[model samples]
Target chain A: MNKIQDIQQFLQDENLDAALITTPDNVFYVSGFKSEPHERLLGVMVFKEAEPFVICPLMEVPDLKASGWNFEAVGHQDTEDAWEVLAAAARKRNVSLEKIAIEKSHLTVERMERMEELFEGVTISRIDEKLNSLRNIKSEDELIKLRKAAELADYAIEVGCKEIAEGKTELEILMAIEFEMKGKGAEKMSFDTMVLSGPKTASPHGKPGSRKIQKGDFILFDLGVVYEGYCSDITRTVAFGEPSEKQREIYETVRKAEQAAIDLVRPGVKARELDKVARDVITEAGYGEYFTHRLGHGLGISVHEFPSITGTNDLELQEGMVFTIEPGIYNPEITGVRIEDDVVVTADGVEVLTKFPKELKIIEA
Target chain B: MNKIQDIQQFLQDENLDAALITTPDNVFYVSGFKSEPHERLLGVMVFKEAEPFVICPLMEVPDLKASGWNFEAVGHQDTEDAWEVLAAAARKRNVSLEKIAIEKSHLTVERMERMEELFEGVTISRIDEKLNSLRNIKSEDELIKLRKAAELADYAIEVGCKEIAEGKTELEILMAIEFEMKGKGAEKMSFDTMVLSGPKTASPHGKPGSRKIQKGDFILFDLGVVYEGYCSDITRTVAFGEPSEKQREIYETVRKAEQAAIDLVRPGVKARELDKVARDVITEAGYGEYFTHRLGHGLGISVHEFPSITGTNDLELQEGMVFTIEPGIYNPEITGVRIEDDVVVTADGVEVLTKFPKELKIIEA
Candidate 1:
């Protein structure tokens, strides 16, 4: 069955009268209409026994139709009460607005209050887990797009590495890399392109600035690209010049931990165990405290999706699940090194999608 | 008093014990720390009778400290219960949590439920409007950053117009503009740079694509830049070659409407009147229906802020308030034209921050 049919069946099985999909990612997955409506309302109302319909801003109706969604679209103007319009549409379809499932993780408190006021007797249940489960396993077509996205991410890393030189600012290198990605037909960066150098790299989520690259400095790059709505994220750290013995040790330790975690990825393995494998490797190297944050996270249409790979999560790794396995060791005063790769679980082993080499490379600056 | 002190006074006046600020922009405005904690929790708790504190992931503690926030930062690890940590912090401050305010517009339904469960006897109220009122008027320091950001945005339009060619794709022109912005020290684009040519420009929020420029095509460029936490937004439609009479007419109508609205910007004028001033101009030209959206919106730290310039809003224009005056006419089959400028209300009149000429420019492609 198709995705919409699968969702309809799920609503029936769960005894939900209808399901309100509002998050842009979930809405795109169901209706093939992608939009970032800032504060505007954009949703797809799927009924168990009635046909599904979409509601969006009036200005987006043409774009919605062009996205190939042929169902009834209820477009509301800025001055109109969108909830009242949505209720009218529901009544027209004769679908009882009782026991509706909604994406609670994404719906804001103000909107939920409005929904409650609109449907006074309705029981609202969260469909976050159900929707995540439906989008977890990758189909063949999704895998194709994912592989292409990963290839583009790898290409971005290659371009960034080549742009690293003495006296160049981190933002300058990032611009060069993104410029090359645009030339390669990338829709956009999966997230903000990160190029943190020296001690700034110690902050994993640091923003790139005008700090010039210098000798004996370690530069970190964490970037990705979106291709056909699928996203790929990869992180790599390289030396600008001959690094010190301590920097080299930290880089090698992170590479080994990342490889160890990747080797532990297969069907029937617990996600938490994979995290422990990487954590233990880093701990054995006496840098456990330096390895902050979770081991990795699931990646697909969104850069960070369901099934987080943390030491506490016990979700079993299954075939067709795609995620990232990244390991890092960061010291604020010294250096920071991270090695990340995208991989898909196979029937027995795992297929590594990102092909960037993880060895320690010192660029002659 | 500073912003935080103003909030403290607001809480006292409203009879609220405390307030929780969770939206990234508000948190940045109050604490001067900007972070995008995807899925993770980041908030600041301010009390009327006690000291304020911040709650964030453990990994962000150092960065939070570096942001010049000198307060108790409650950091929680991934495995820790952040709610329990937050409650402990509240107890340490001896602040009563019986009544609290929150940004209802931004807090998700799931988070609201969590908050309810954490503080069982607390009565929650919406603080969205209060915060907006506080941030509505720009301080002198903010005006300086906004003026610089507006200058950068004008420069971006100039670069984009120069890059127009017969065979260049919309994405190519966008890249050229963004590369120039980054080179000129822009931290980042306030929003995704839009470059829509020909009929595609009819969609005001259309994404840039691989559509190549052609003769007699009207290309719309709506873009902005962020400089030191302030944002600037500007839109201009330029002709690729000698345009037809119809295109020129539409362009002139929009230009006239935009200028008329700008001329109406003075203290004591209603926001709705400014919107009507522009709408009336387009309607007199028999293109009322073609202008499908609002005239413009408030601009500052965020591109779209409070005091929306729509025909329905009755908020009065006040000194120190900054906003945009944009007017557009979109005919799906023929073409689209828009002219926008950022302006700040002065003591007597107004100061147009963006200096790009609104006169129709036909580039020789």
Candidate 2:
């Protein structure tokens, strides 16, 4: 994946003097270094001709070097502004600081102002689209990491299914799932692990609470895992005890919709096509309004990335693109059901990374 | 806490036409609603006179209402730009967009540009300082939530201590601690749960890995919990077995430094004073160079908030202000030891919210 080369080519083709890549995800993508700087600054500065350099908190220098980034890494003390360091470092390359590009959507107003103040008269433009386009297609190495993440996510769902029992609180099951995941060498959950049960499941983004799982409760486990630097997201809803007719109907409808979306994932297929296919499946089952929100989002370094699967996005699916196909029916009066699978677009068709069964699993408590 | 009224008063005093609060912490501080908007926009538009309005994704409108935001909550679909919805909602207030204020430190350059494009000739100024000042002091209810969060964090450390074993990997101990926290009803960790053991403990901000803890090694548990909206951060390092002379010296130095800083916490004392007191202690121990980074940061809605406990910050301590007092001595050639505590400035002295003992514990595991 000619990452730095791709960014350098973008700079040269656009006639921009340089590009300042902020945002931890983009920084990691460019430099192969991972550091959650939080309030501190971490940037990857690429040039039209000069070698790229990194500017980060002084403490993270060793980490950057360990990450295989051999380029100059300028370290700033806590008291110093990182932009000043960046400007000084960029000047060291003897390049004119004019017409620079940046991650406009990520660089804060405060930081941007600081950058402007440091680099006098520099015209900045957005490089977000270029970076997003470059990161959209995953490489074979990234796929390997994603596949491992998906395996752990599937195991989390399996643990959630096993831990579901009568009188067990939603968080109790969540704890068991996360505990097992960490023990299995998962770095961390891609996002907050969700385990919702009974009526709580109807809340589209429900927080696991002390509400105990009762008989006939439908337990929904939506969780993911981060393996290395890649992420995988999976959602699986299981029925505890025998489910009611309405619950069974909702579960089957979401399963069909999710499968419909998964089936349309291939090269040249528009992202919107998958959304339309899934939406139609849910709409035909008379739960169109219940199936709210978009069908899916691209998944890789971040659990949610680019090329959103919605009815309006016209982006064509490309091979090596990994994403989640999650379609849910949240009906408070009836029941909530969602089926999710992490899939990677393939040259032929698709490879579903998440192997967790989509069929209804009614666990006997 | 008279939060909204305080914001309105600030707007009136500053002669601001309106304020666009975008950061989730500030939004939740002003209004009761909380959301992780991810890439989508979540903003609270407050005026000097007009009722505050919230703009969020259509899917989160219900959650916003449930969170007790009774005023207008303009919900935007996934396809719609939330900034457009926010602009329309502000226009409906019939107030001049001129002389608006924004959280410049949190708002992205892209969003700031969008605002300028939408509201032509709008003069925007930073309200970040005002917001931070307003949130500096905690109320009775806020303190209650913080205390609960601290209690949970202490319990987490207790769990970690019990789970420590000779052959256990760092991740195994971390899993046990997090599992206990989740079962005890922590919303989530304020940050990633950190459990570093042996040589890994020397790496400040090290990720818990499969590194096994042998006999003579230091185990550091640095984690926090988010209770309701408040956050608590605590770091405690313990010896798995009999420590070396250097390890003991480092531990004692950091503990003394942390205690010295905590002892200096009172009304009217400068934030820098505490940092100096801690820094001085470590310096006198001949480990001045080893102790890097700031002493701590203000803790409340956000784990790392305003009034960063740095030697350079001149913020004055006041009653009801909550923050962490952490001091560490990280010498890669030797070992690392850190001790942290959550403390609240009281009328007379400081109330240590984190009750975990600071005394070094030598666990014969």
Candidate 3:
């Protein structure tokens, strides 16, 4: 994918010996292999001059080979200490271990200490910013997977809307949506499929429970799908039956806020400007205190990635930058309403990947 | 729960001022509150003398309070720096930040540097070992939850078996099993549900895909359930129809090895002994090298936890210690067969929590 070579070039430019990319997403990004090495070590060690090598669990070596990585691939046994194996692999390169760049945001303190103990006063710098920026701009191939993922998410929302019934629990609807997603070939969800309902929706991060849906309840489905290697997140809140005036107002305010943010997505536009436009929409509606979280986040290989769309982040929206535009108002006394859409910035303007309707739908169950 | 008080007492005994529990599992363990803060921050700061506090994203403050945590629970907005909020909370305790304990295994180097920057030259000790020891022995209440989780896992396996048929994809069977698990009130799977078929089973960590199941194929179902807060993992591989002689031999050898390990679990026995016994059985059967991974891992609130059951670990199993005793043989030339069960070390011997038939089942469809 030329990503490893790019890292090597980055190391040369920064005058670093090497860079250790270990986070599963970054590993997949650097090498064309995807694996979730839970607890086990998985890394792609890229040297400025030497050829890059991928180190993973011994069993995944064959899988890595099948993934088309022509570079050297090393694996460690379950009984062996993976860190020492990783160190030995690096030593074979014959590069002086003086300065190295690691993902300081992902590498644990324990692992960093082990690396230091192995390499001796190796001045460790961060590879986070460089990696984040490189990953921010999506390639054409990534956009294809992302667009497919968005289509699946839109279908999931449709299925979820159809599954809403009189006495069905939140879990039942959630199970139906995920089961349908699996049938449609979504290997996994970007995150846990949240199917929060009623007052439970007031908490932005509420879990799907056995709470039965009833009349006058606002059901919130904040979910995403991972297709190929890309991710798409979309949230749609619909009313079960007839809703109160307060519910409609909250829904309208959130829709306006979300739309405003998406409209401001264009090349050369500061990411924070979009956030302010969305925040201003919700604030002018007198729901400012209720809108608690950030506007949105970047989406790609990782559902939540670089260029956080927050009021504080001043990152400019360059062409090919894909992200989410979500804004919500959560008032426990009334109801919580959130509308989100996956968007990609283009040279001229923005393209909203998720096609789910933003208008509040009153589902007559 | 007196867990917070226990941590405070440990702090006094260890001559440390405070301990920062940032890992989501540890956060849920110390405070009765559970949360996954993603990129945001969530922690439990337990001081020796001052009152402990739970810090989370501002949006989750109400949810934290609802979890019945009476102690002070602080929240930070997305716009505000979470690390600074965490430091300010510690400062409010009025305790000298001379020495502090942190989960070095979970806290990232970036966060550790931030913490060190906040508390100038503070001696940072590790709370990993102490926390691991505390969580190793399950309480009676925890056992109840584990038992329920194990039952759900057994049910999931039964569902998976029933759904396996000719022309059925591995993901189809996995979807059905997970759908039924949700129907039975299982909030989540301990890990990603694995249903590997035929040659795919040869990879111990194979992912379920669109590959159709055929006759003479070894179908592996490695899954778990999370009930309440406890987790249970179980793996069972059955033949789709009449298997080949080699498949039967591998299956029986794995079964025998698993049984031998399960029989060896008891108080005073080293964790490595079980791994060795299982390894010896497979080695005697002439497929020792095929059993690539470790025997299993300790299980509780977290699916994979302390005291990994490997050939090198010498940790002694004590009463109320719960873990998985899984042994498998994955030969890509033939097929993979794994037999797993959740067992707890009792005062006298062991009690297998997962009640599922381990006999080689030939599913004729």
Candidate 4:
């Protein structure tokens, strides 16, 4: 069944009168229209009995229809009240507006209050969990796009590694990587393209700056690209020159942990167990305290999606599930190393989508 | 007084016990620490009678401190409950949490419900309007950064114009413009860079694709850059070659409307009046219906900020208020033309931050 039909089925099974899907991602998932409306209202109202319709900025109506969204679209101009338009559309549908389910995780309190006022005495229910569960399993078409996106991400890392040299600033290297990616038809980066060198890499979420690369310093490249709406994220840390024993050890530890976590990724394995497998490898090498973050997160439409792979999550791995396995060890006084790869869980094993090598490559500078 | 003090005073004046700021822009505005937590909890709790503190991801504590946030930062790991950490921090402050104001426009329903459970029976009030009012006026330092950002944006448009030629795809031109901007030290674009040509320009929010430019086609360039945490947005439409009479007429109409709107940017002028000044010009040119969107929006730390300039808003323009004056006329069958300028309302008149020329330029192809 199509995604919209699946959502309608969910509403019927859950006994929801209708569902108010907010957030650009959910809206795009339900309808084939994607828009970054900023503060403007953009939503899809799906009913179990009635047809689904989209309410968005009037300027976006044509584009929404052009995106293959065949449902009715209620457009509101800047001068008009968007809520009134949404309410009118709901009234026109003649469906039960009571007991409407909303994406509570994405809808703001202000919008929620407005929605309540629009539909007085309506019982609002949270559908965030249901939506996440629905989005977790990847379809074949989604996987195809995801695999292509992964290929682009791997190519980005390759270009970044080749651009590395002594005296080149991290910002310059990042620019080269993104420029090449754009040239190769990347719609945009999944997230900020991070390229941190030396001690700057110690910060797990460090921004690329004007810090120049030095001999023997480790440079970390964590970036992703969006292709056909799906996303791919990968991280690889390489040495600019012959590394010290400490740098090499840290790099090797992270590589082993990442590989072990990937090896454990199969159907029926708990997410917590995968995280533990990686953490144990780093802990055995005496870098337990340095491994600060979670193992990885689910990756698809957004870089960080549902089902986080952390030490506490008990979500079992399932076939068709796609996520990342990134293990890192960071010590500000020494070095930081992270190796990430996108993976898809198969019936019995896992298919690694990102093909970039994780072995520490010492580039002559 | 600093921004934090301003919020504390607002809390006291409003008889609220404290304020919880959750939006990233508001957090950065209040604490000088900016972070994109990506679903992770990051907020600042400002008390009326006690010291303020920040609750953020553990990995961001050091960076928060480095941003000159001297307050106590309560950090939580992925395995820990961030709300519990926040509760502890609030308890340590010993401030009354009975009545707290929150950014209702930004805090999601899920987070609001969690906060409600954490502070059982707490009286939650909306402070979104107050926050918008506080951030509406640009400080001198902020204006300085905004001016620099505007300069960078103008430079980007210049680079984009130079890269434009017949047979060059819109995506290629956009890539060239962004690559040049990055090389010139731009941290990031304020919004997605739009380079639409010919019929594609009719969609005001069109994304740049692989459509190559052709002779007599109008190319729209709407882009901005972020510098020193401030944002600048500018839009200009240029002709690829000698344009038809219709294209030239539409281009001149937009230019006239933009100039009329910018000329009306002064202290004591109503926002609605300024919008009318532009709308009147387009309406007189027989393209009123074609001009679909609002005249413009406020621009600062975030590109699209508060005090939207529309035909309905009656808020009076004031000194230190920075906004945009963009006017466009789009016809799908023919072409589209838009001229935009970032302006700061001065005590007497206005200061145009974006200095790129608005006159239609006919580039040889």
Candidate 5:
């Protein structure tokens, strides 16, 4: 982990005169401040050799003050016209027009145009890759938060599973699960608590509905917990009653695939190759075509980040990078089966962050 | 309602060769296709003198087809990039994109750059005013959906008030209200349900917490219901048990301001003037400085759209424009009060869409 000064040294090593951090993850990684939800204000941390300055809306000054971070804080009244304040800060810092690096992935065309108006005759290029390289490895503090988040999710899911019985609607189950998380002291949910059941489970990202819980239905429960700005995600599918022969077969197939994917998570392994590890298992079982969407994605500040684990991704897995390994077989009209776990690449192998049982569970009520 | 021919004629009258509609509201308004959540695709509907063409991702083709709109649909493979497909569509139409009018208000800088690359040699300017004008006037179909959405919110709020009592956490009440909306068949919540109680209510956009409801505390519940694509927002503040003298004073002041703002909403009235109608009441009550944030904002496709009802807003209210008239007072460490309702300006005066009772209710446990 680098101090503010060490970050500048890294920037110098990367040949970036000054790197502008805009995305919330990049800002939290560099400055350690996580803004509230739906907040439109941006956090800009400019790196010189040994200094970093933050620019945000004026309303957030009190919050920045409470964070105890050592950085210059500049504020503007409204974000709609905050370029003048940011440009003035740049001028005050004696930043040259050339050699300025900004986040290519996060900066919008309108913001760039506004920057152009403020910092006239400046050369700007992408510094996102360098930032991503730094953020790919999580710090000890990050891991602690991640582990706590996973524990909260595990606890919430345990209670949610107990609440899933015949006659309960999908909406009721979702509320019960979220309520469990709230009771456990979670600030908010990492994502919408998914409680899709029966035929609706066929849609991987289906919103919970008022469908009543029926016997002999494939129930897909994908949920997460957000604790201290970090997130954890997990998915578990269960049979409400006596499962059909096809359901039993598909459940076994997905379980084996998920185990293979989790086993392949280790340092020095390519994320895409690991995805293929599970993808191949499902394909060999002749359910490859039914498996839709990516196997997994990186989880961090915003729930979905870099180092995606998909068959087409080429990024290599590294120590400290955490992500989910979720594989599913969706048969739209009939049923679906998916098993997910959050895995963090360790020095030698991998550590499963989610501790909930991954085996198929049959609950009859 | 005007057909595609009318849009083409409107584009011609505006002296724009081609207009790009990218915002979800504008896209649905023109093409009648609701964009799904988590969709990385964009809908670019091009108008050329009485004809329209839509360019959407291949994965969305099925849903778009079912929409029953007669337009050319381009579907690219899931693995393929979306920008390339959009570029090909633009070329096939032979659209001379020079001097193109675009939705600068909502288009991201990155997406706008991609549009430039597709056009190669073209000028793009803001079409925010024209598009906003088109979306502000509600049609019969839109009104029906809006009314339905309002009904759901009204019902949910009634249930929420009935359940509010001492010994309940804010998050519990919020989840209950949201689940109630889902029970009645809401596709999704318009936005995150806000259940700010006690002193936490001082912040207009405060997130719900585990703070238990207490006796003599003012509870402010702000929530919205989403039916189909349209949305409705309503806020109600009630006292747990009997109110203190200060609580009653603040609540009555906010109620008067809220009523005044709603009464001032009518065709030909300046939006700023309507905001002042609320601001004046709060100011006269000696809580002007405590009333942070805007008086109200437009409510339709997005909760906070255009024609913001603020002291600085310069736009004039018009017929068929629906928005919220919410006036609030925030006293940190004490209590807060806010009353909001959805109101539509009519040819004669104004029509309140939400029918929830506003009289302060005292909940006894």
Candidate 6:
């Protein structure tokens, strides 16, 4: 009832009758069920100024019995066409297919064509941005999971920092950290655990390899953890020896910039403007071009989500939205330093969730 | 040049003038460049009896330089604006838009509509099945990597089986095996390591959890190793004690069925017919309904690929086709047993790539 009401409010404000969600993340957002990737099913949550109904495959009815949802179950055999089941659900709900809005971002050509053929007179419009907007604001349950995910990442890096040393390959370090995370009950890594040392750290998304870690190398570990279907991302850099004056200065500048970006994250602030706050600082420090990728991205069900923290986006920050504040300076031949933290937007300020020490640490081999 | 000729011959046989490929796997198959997912970039490999041209983002050019391919590379930033790039390539090739075929299976709706808009006169017939046919066969280079992947999986599981015990949790076993695989230089896992024990093994793809191992429980470990983008899959079941008579009976039935399925695979045989070899064996044993999913799927760049080993698919097995022959039986409340192996169809017979010991092993906890 609570999720249905939330959808009703979202539809009323977004001016949509019903949303045909095909993305598992969006479906999980609306319905409580978390399906495996190969489920090959679509979940439709419709709002028509009343309680919403979840239309799913008939085999999933037994799984959803405890969800306390209203009944509109349609179980069909594999040989039975899915269109017939969907059409029957539409007729039962008295939903005018002409007003149905579908997520253009996730809908495939095959599925869209099948839907068009099933409801011959239906009007299907793109409602992708509206669904993204609904997901932008994190709920209480989401924040709880996000915070735990951040804690897991923090603990993982703590293990990685202790295990990283000279003669250890980047691949070895990555495996060790992943081992520690899985030991602590992480479902899986949010993404590939990036362990780049020295010159290899210059690339934003470098793959971990057998390149041996050596003394005087600047080690950068960018990793994340997936916990309870939510994701947390964090990156930290350390010097394997006494840092050069240049490395020290660059690390301090990036630390200040990352904290500055996090400080600007509050309700009613423009996301792009906050990006510029950190960007301008690095630009003044003469490392502007080196910071090539976006400042951050909204994270939840997927690793990267909408409202990119880039100069091109004009979306406003709102309370309950959680994102990352990662700022870096990469020089291909010399060194790379990146510091990242997960932050949740609050009414007055921001809450930093990750607690891994980011201050440039000097580790001796 | 050889791949280009192969596609040209395929296009000529199909009576198609040109074909547009947008799927990343298809692109990688043709161009040898693996791209990032969910990006605005498109890797279009076109064929018309000449060297293939690759249309991709501007940033990938540096990486492509090392491949030594004969492709004419065109780079573009805007996806909508990239149609002109494709059009210019087509115009340069002296091929008009008509009679063009596209990979319909992988094309997104947004890109499909754009292609239609720019090349209004072209007939974009679905060339999906043809592309899958080409990808089904593996090249010598691909087989070398697959063999290495299989060797890594074999060694890792051998190490894993030694560590299984009564007090170990499923998650612990998965991590232990994954760590051992990483130690052996696997870039990543082909899929999530499924380590299910006791009744939990009934679910084909059960998530590893905190459930501790117990005496006389069926321990199923389904895992794969990814080495240099090639995948290898293997599954083995172990009983913590002397398995019950019924358990041994089920295990033997699955082993026989899996071996029979492997024996049936060869050039010129239909994949579905091979699936029936296993299905019939399990069905005749009175455990037919418990084998819920497909027998197997093609294994290559992606863990699960084309030419699904299901009764409905009519694709014929080719000499270089590599796939899994996994036959399983799940008793809802009792236990489950699955024995899977990677098989490569040869000219005269099939070669099993997965060398992991499949016999039911009784181990003391």
Candidate 3 per-residue lDDT, tens place, B140-231, comes to 88899999999999999999999999999887888889878877889789889999999999988677888999988889999999887789
* lDDT top scorer: 3
Name the candidate that leads on DockQ. Answer: 2
Off by over 4 Å in 5: A1-17, A36-39, A332-334, B1-15, B37-39, B49-51, B332-334
Say which candidate scores most in TM-score: 5
Off by over 4 Å in 4: A93-95, A162-169, A211-218, A239-247, A331-335, A359-365, B93-95, B162-169, B183-185, B197-202, B211-219, B239-249, B331-335, B359-365
RMSD of 4: 2.9
Q: What DockQ values do the models have?
A: 0.59, 0.61, 0.57, 0.56, 0.52, 0.38
Q: Write the per-residue lDDT of candidate 1 for residues A93-186, one digit (tens) a residue.
A: 8777888999989998899889889888889999889889978888888899899999999999999999988899998898889878987888
Q: Which consecutive 10 residues in model 4 chain A have the weakest lDDT in total?
A: A1-10
Q: Model-by-model lDDT, in order? A: 0.90, 0.89, 0.91, 0.90, 0.79, 0.80
For model 2, the stretches where C-alpha displacement exceeds 4 angstroms are: A165-168, A212-215, A242-246, A362-364, B165-169, B211-218, B239-250, B331-335, B362-365
Itemize residue pairs with steric clashes in candidate 4.
none
What does fnat come to for each candidate? 0.80, 0.80, 0.75, 0.80, 0.45, 0.20
lDDT of each residue in B246-270, candidate 1, tens digit only: 9999999999999999999999999
- CAPRI-wise, candidate 4 is medium
User: Residue A27 of candidate 6: its Cα lDDT?
Assistant: 70
Native-referenced TM-scores of chain A, all candidate models: 0.96, 0.97, 0.95, 0.97, 0.93, 0.92
Per-residue lDDT tens digits for candidate 6, residues B145-257, read 99889888888778777878888888778877887787788977898888899999888867888889999899998889888879998888889898888888888889999
Clashing pairs in 1: none
**Overall local distance difference test of candidate 2:** 0.89
Per-residue lDDT tens digits for candidate 2, residues B1-365, read 27778888988999988899999999999898888888788988888889888888887898899998888989998667777788888988888779899988899999999999999999989999998988899988999999999999999999999998888888788878887787787888899899998878777868888889889889999999999988999999999889889899999999999999999999999999999999999999999998877899999999988778998888889998999999999888778888999999999889999999988999996
Candidate 6 lDDT at A92 equals 65
- Candidate 1 stretches greater than 4 Å from native: A65-71, A162-169, A197-202, A211-219, A238-249, A331-335, A359-365, B161-169, B197-203, B211-219, B239-248, B286-289, B331-335, B361-365
Q: Between the candidate structures 1 and 2, which one is better when assessed by DockQ?
A: 2
Encode model 3's per-residue lDDT on A32-75: one tens digit a residue: 89998988899999988888899999978998999999999999
Docking class of 6: acceptable
Q: Give every collision pair in model 6.
A: A58-A75
